[model samples]
Target: MDWNKAADNAQTLMQAHEALSRLMPRPDAPQQTWLAYYRRSAAVYTRVAEIDRGHFHETMFWATREREKAEAMEQSALA
Candidate 1:
């Protein structure tokens, strides 16, 4: 794996996560229901960053874990 590319991708993913986080709904916003959407987006980018760090199989495992967490959070929010 090219470390340079991996580093660049990680940076990009982190940046995207930051951007998505910034778009989260305000505390009193009526659209607060959408916060989970933003959180999941950020978590997805975080998983991509982990994969980009050259962890391959490990990253995949953690990504799946994170996805499960996001799904549970989303479901709880809906409930």
Candidate 2:
């Protein structure tokens, strides 16, 4: 497992999360933007979960404790 690759992926995921968060509705905005942002955020979160699962499985093959940590991170992200 390449730590660099994992770090890069984490950065990308965080950026997506930030972008989606900014799209949140404002009092003066239309309802459609709010709905769109919600859907987009959901999709981003799903992608993050998938990435996390993959990372967890890959790391688990080498270290059980690392796997557990990864799984916890994935669960926290979902929650």
Candidate 3:
């Protein structure tokens, strides 16, 4: 993937993490939502660490996949 695409995906993941963190303390929130958010954040952070260690392709692949999944979950929450 191009650098722009990777950056956008990373940003999306970061935003998702932020949203999830905000929702965490709400008593009415579903448990699965928190778990999904945690997994998404872990995936993004892991990919970022890999990039810092010089693993570009692995970083891009994981970021793209996880960001897509996170975005889907976010949309589902909206619905």
TM-score of each: 0.38, 0.41, 0.37
Model 3 lowest lDDT segment of ten: 1-10
TM-score of 2: 0.41
> Can you write out model 2's per-residue Cα lDDT over 1-79, one digit (the tens) per residue?
1113333244244544455445545756654444444444454444555565645443333233334444554566679
Highest TM-score among the candidates is held by which one? 2
| Clashes in predicted model 2 | 0
Candidate 1, overall lDDT?
A: 0.51
Model 3 gets an lDDT of 0.52
The candidate, 2 or 3, that scores higher on lDDT is 3
lDDT to native, each model: 0.51, 0.45, 0.52
TM-score of model number 3: 0.37
List candidate 1 stretches off by more than 4 Å.
1-8, 11-54
Q: Clashing residue pairs in candidate 2, if any? A: none
